[model samples]
Target: MIKKHLIYKKDKWNMLTVEVNGKTLILREISDQWGEECHTFLSRPAMMHWVEERFPKEQFEGSEEEWTAIMQAFKEV
Candidate 1:
């Protein structure tokens, strides 16, 4: 089962936790932006980068289901 728990929502962004295989991974959603313009879906690269940069100490690697859950979490959050 996929479980989504909201961490927080501030301004135009929302942070959530998605559980997969009994482990929880962080996922975030924000108003999409491209180049010098704002658009519709959040950037996947940006989301991965944020997790890597801010939580460098974490040994994070995602499974296929985890990735799916992350995407769904962003959409539903």
Candidate 2:
């Protein structure tokens, strides 16, 4: 089963953390930039870096496991 959790949402931009077949991914949609930008991240560090750079921690909305997965990536670096 595929599980999707919305981590953040705002004008023309939103992010989703998805779990599928035991793998995790971060997906983003940014309609405000260049007519629309879609991104997918499987790398933990990449996910952590992008989220840390753009969104606030308090804005995240997801399960503890999902949040921990992202933070664990940050700590691994």
Candidate 3:
């Protein structure tokens, strides 16, 4: 089963971790201009930030489904 856990606490954001099979992922909440959480806004610069931090190893030459899955993973929490 996939397990997501709170790894750290912060004033304006949080650090979360998810483990599945033999792999792990770290995620963070993305906020908007008003500090509202917005996930899956691929057209926004925030998405660039998320990609840079969350999936830095990704080559960005894969299918869109890959990105969707990553974003959905964070949203599922």
Identify the candidate with maximal TM-score: 2
Q: How many clashes show up per model?
A: 0, 0, 0
lDDT of 2 at 18: 36
**Candidate 2 residue lDDT tens string, 11-69:** 53543343333455545444445454545676756766776765456666766766666
* lDDT (Cα, tens digit) per residue for candidate 3, span 27-49: 34433333433243423344447
TM-score of each: 0.27, 0.41, 0.29
Error of 2 at 22 (Å): 3.7
Tell me the whole-model lDDT of each prediction, alpha carbons only.
0.43, 0.53, 0.46
Candidate 2 vs candidate 3, TM-score winner: 2
Q: lDDT, candidate 1, residue 11?
A: 45
Give, for candidate 3, the lowest lDDT window spanning 10 residues.
18-27
Model 2 lDDT, full chain set: 0.53
Q: Write candidate 1's Cα lDDT for 4-26 as tens digits.
A: 55533434533444333233344
Error of 3 at 24 (Å): 15
Clashes of 2: 0
Which candidate, 1 or 3, has the higher lDDT?
3
Q: Residue 38 in model 1: shift from native, Å?
A: 17
